[model samples]
Target chain A: MDMQSVITAAIEAVAAEQGKTLRPLTDDLVLLESGLDSLCFAILVTRLEDEVGFDPFTLSDDVYFPVTLGDFIRFYDDAARSQAAPTLAA
Target chain B: MQHAAKPLRRWLLEAERGRGRALLAPGTRLTLDALADTTGLGALRGALADRNVLVSTGSQLAAAEALVELDGLARRIVLAPPDLKPTDIPAVMAGAGIDAVLCDGDHPGFGPDVLIAVPGPRVPLPDAAAAEVRDTEWVLLTSGTTGLPKMVAHSRAGLIGAIDPSALAPVWGTFYDIRRYGGLQILLRALIGGGSMVLSQAGEPMADHMARLAAAGVTHLSGTPSHWRRALMTPETASIDPRVVRLSGEIADQAVLDSLRRAFPGVAVGHAYASTEAGVGFEVTDGREGFPAALLDADGAVAMKVEDGSLRIRSTRTASRYVGGTARALADRDGFVDTDDLVERRGDRMHFVGRRSGVINVGGLKVHPEEVEAVINRHAGVRMSLVKAKSNPITGAIVVADVVIERTFPDTDAARAQAGLKAEILDLCRATLPAHKVPVLLRFADALAVTPAGKLARHNA
Candidate 1:
């Protein structure tokens, strides 16, 4: 599956686990407002790790600054693409 | 063999030279000199002289040395607990009359007048004559679980004197060589004693902390009961040297102490009774269940007083005031700070009856959640437990326990195990606790919510 499709699936899984439905995780929907507390956000990161093969949660930087779902997805996509570029080049 | 200067800075400098040991926390290991440099005590002297400085930092060493540096500069320092929320910051600032704030990067925003920033390398200010301040000038905030937080003010000399390092000297040789008061106290005492401070950035992983302790050859280690409990449950902790384990924070129960003794065999297990308001009160090295009432005054309170079974303490070591409120007298008419903990004395030892707010009135008989939770926690399958008083029309308030089971149990069959475990816990409570104190309601939760400070959120339980 494409990165966007994987991101959508992960978001849906998180929403399901939280017993709620998301109105499509657009770039404008704030993660905090979407009911992703620190713990849930951690679980989401773990799920994304499984699907995307890379965990983006690093303590040295602020990964939670992106407010909306689209913003988070874009950030993840860029990170995944960059992470994969070296391997593809090899 | 001997150091002449008695200043806190001098003590830390001495420790750095003598120990040559590093205090390790995750990716950081700070030497005494590095810590001293970061505080910039020399420059802070001018900015903080005769001013109240509020320190907000997660690094125990930084917080501890900052206290010492502020003391050296004659600045009144208020050490805030790690779990202090941003919402309560304004009130604490106003209550303590905090003139400035010193924080690390993790700390949030502060007011413009608030001198909020990280401590750079070295003491920047020039040395000047010590600033004058009143005796009863330091303030600490109450945990505020039962009601609104209050400021407990104390005199600098008096507060420092309350530490009673001699009481800790016995077990110090056995545990990690680092001073114990959680991390903050460890750093403060290490700096004061001129001993090396160790840091462990072991997130929630018990194995990581054990590895750090083993790698550092840490002979003195202190932590909250919860931290110790987590360590005990972890398999890796058994293989690590137990001779250096020193437990503090909450009251040490017999089961927990016995468990530690069994695990560490030769290690000395101990306990301490202290609060933000009372500073350090009493120490128990024999692994006693409760603190001795004699350690307290006539009120049967430890470190303070017993107000209708609620512990209260008055000390020169108390905080100046709440951060946002006017300076109110922490002492009663007779001059003692109340700690608000309930207690029952037996001979020389006193047992904590649990917090007054945690007491549940079941059919007119009082029940402490801790008493019930202790029974629940002792269960083989349970990892942690929180017991709270839930309203019941017939009983007024009944004891309800929420338990978090260890992951070793199968997830699919967790409900069945939880039911069996709940029965086992109920049976244990019935055997040990009084009929009224026995928990009537049992809940098996995936996890218990904890505060930033690693304390269970008992208020919401």
Candidate 2:
């Protein structure tokens, strides 16, 4: 139901695709330095886009390179909030 | 020397001798004059004089320049793919017997000092080097679908002799990286034919790349069926309209051919049959799946035959030798080299029947099943593993693995243990194998199906 749980479920789905297990998710967990390889990270982003209905990587004009799990979750959160911000302004 | 009839180097020098567009990419463009002056290519000519050099630049411009200049400068030149993992570079360098590596940017952490960055800006080309393009050996790596990539040695003359002269346009675009065999053919075709090219950078988005090629006004475009399929799926496909569209590397099945024909109506669509060992073979422009049956014995530039279902080809352009690995002869007494690609007679033509060797083609790239299986088998909990191909709509085929675990767990928690082991095995595979070679699907089986011959069955569920 929460942003963190949504991100974690997507990550787990990708890890499940490769039969990989992830270290427990934490704020400072370096995604690249974690068990996820580049391919798994890519799949995670793609799957998360489908589940959450917004892909931060594509929506942001400014390139955002998120190294940690918190940065990744916040990236989507910021994109989602930004989408709602326009509505809030209206 | 006749201007129209010249080798790749001579044509490049004459066409771009003053200042001509030699290479083009999205953010980078190098002229013949710029290539000669700034790229340290002139200095590289002298530095590699009488020496064997490996042109392994990650930059497309640098690679094109190195390949063009090194033809006459180096006694032996090996073109190593820039995408090769850092850990795989040393063995490749040592195997190719390279004395120096011509690259730009950071050293890929191999043969540290052997890296000679492509030279920088100079006023004029270095005083004409005394080196003549002697029996200069051109070594290229075969896409190791069966085992480790092997260095296939070829001569400049042999490579150039195969280019079919064309009166087509000047601008060319190709999906191949010049480092590989298929890409080199396109590179040489443009170089020897006095044409410019739009180089596709690896890892660039296909839609954007297609748009770039369109913006470059590319008249002739060449790519694998997988590439064309991927490109068509992209929204930018409508932007590029090439006069000539060619496919190679993987089988151009009727479905792909028809789709390409439908997508690019009125454009010429054709596929050529060629391999690392066989050089360039017969090409069919009939918009069909395979070459005409008559090419088997027709008097042509090359010769072909089918022996025990495998196609064999012999021609001047065929590879000169296998540089590394077992010193086994590549060809038999009569010059015919077995392509190891099985072919079957289908009506009036011969259709490719997959590789006789157990190599699965994932798109245009080859993924050796045994190689992935070996990595999977290394996992502590994996008792045995069987890697095989699973067809996909995008990539022609993807890798899938079936593994039998070494240990058993209680029924309630068996699923959890199985999932854990599966992930571990995949992790091990990712560390050892290339990304494409990693199995897309991992399944834990009670037992792997075996053939009557007591070998693990590879195909069919």
Candidate 3:
């Protein structure tokens, strides 16, 4: 699955597990308003990390928290692409 | 050279106080004189004499019945709770110098060459006479989740210090497993202080256990605040009309205390501080969350001092020494056991914030999960909450929480009252706690998991 599909599926799984229904996974949808709490997001991140090879959240020196569904998917994809082809970390 | 302390039977506060009162459980009922003649271990009595014996009974009631007979005969009595990991048996037995294994049915297989069968309380009074009793060392295992459990050795007097030598016998009940320190205290209280006790069975549902306690007419009931909170959610809670209620093992937050007061009106609800290593520290009785500040200054039987935010206790109730796993002093130079429980002074009273080693380092700022959970639990809608850390690349970790809502509140969807409840809980946290300690995210769980020891299970992800 692509990063977007994996992230969306994880969100659905976590939300269902927490007995929550998602509002929408649109790019502009605010993360806090996505009917998922921080704990659910943490769980989603964990699931995504296990499905993928790494977590972008732990790779960067600068503190980063994806604010939306698009941002979360993009961060994972970027991390995956960067790992595929060696590039300067900066 | 010293004479053995008064034997356990001699410590019975009132031999004839509560007539017909017996140690009660699901299938067995043993009166105080249940072992006057037959002990089931008659054949092995000579083999176990003067040896360190491990009481690895199948049930707490069985263990209780065995302790009554084994105390004076055995040089050391090591209590092994039923939930002890099978792998920890060797370390525990070797550390306690266990020479024999006593059980209701079969032994744990690896402990010792000598395995003694305990007939429990229901055995027919046999021809064998009661075993000789004496003052013996009582070794209790600390319910630590990680690594091998610590073995804290205690003298008979030290273990029973909190128990008054009186004739007031009230049927006692507790949520603690009998082998742990807290449950042992309740057992000793019932035995030495002239009362019968109803023991909780392993894997019994909370509601069924409460119903059993109610059926047994338990007057003095005690448990951790987590145990009480989970119990309150069950419909059986209001049925058990306890005269005296006690909370230990975890921080008794104000919300739980208030809820208990409402549930059992006119009952004496109290919170006490105690640990396997520290013994029975003190009890806070004024219907408050934390103890009074004057407790440290007063000339009381249990001397306490707070230095560098940690509570230190010096009392006869404190365990004498650590027996196994690690070799470290149980008490300091001044005979004070460092509780390692941090506290903060709030005006005239001080509240236990959390354990010193349990801090969640959030971006270099320290946050105690118990302290944060206490604030969140104060919210009316919250039944119980567990605050723990979630790993984050930026700050290394972020505070998160799992909240169990009061049963009355409906949460069909996260967008319904749960959102409002979350907002209210977050507001409560923000109003009282700092920004960092405020749980960044809270998940609504039907129930929060509690450890086998009955404390809220706190695991950082």
Provide TM-scores for the models.
0.69, 0.64, 0.84
Better of 2 and 3 by lDDT: 3
Q: What would the DockQ be for model 2?
A: 0.03
Which parts of model 2 have CA positions greater than 4 angstroms off? A1-90, B1-8, B16-20, B36-44, B108-117, B129-132, B359-461
Where does model 1 sit among the CAPRI classes? incorrect
Task: Using DockQ, rank the candidates from best to worst.
Answer: 3, 2, 1
RMSD of each: 15.0, 17.6, 7.0
If both were scored by lDDT, which would come out higher, candidate 1 or candidate 3? Answer: 3
Angstrom error at residue B168, model 1? 10
Residue-by-residue lDDT tens digits, candidate 3, A9-85: 88897786567889978987888899986656666665566678677877777777888877877888989998788
Model 3, position A89, has a per-residue lDDT of 67
In order of listing, the candidates' clash counts read: 64, 3, 2
The number of clashing residue pairs in model 1 is 64
Q: After superposition, how far is residue B343 of candidate 3 from its true place, in Å?
A: 0.7
Report candidate 3's fraction of native contacts. Answer: 0.09
lDDT of 3 by residue, B12-120 (tens): 4225644777778887787776544346665566777788888988788778877876777889999997678889988998898887878777654663366555553
DockQ score of each predicted structure, in the order shown: 0.01, 0.03, 0.11
Per-residue CA lDDT of model 1 for B196-265, tens digit only, reads: 4446442436677676666665566677676676777778775566445666656566767777888788
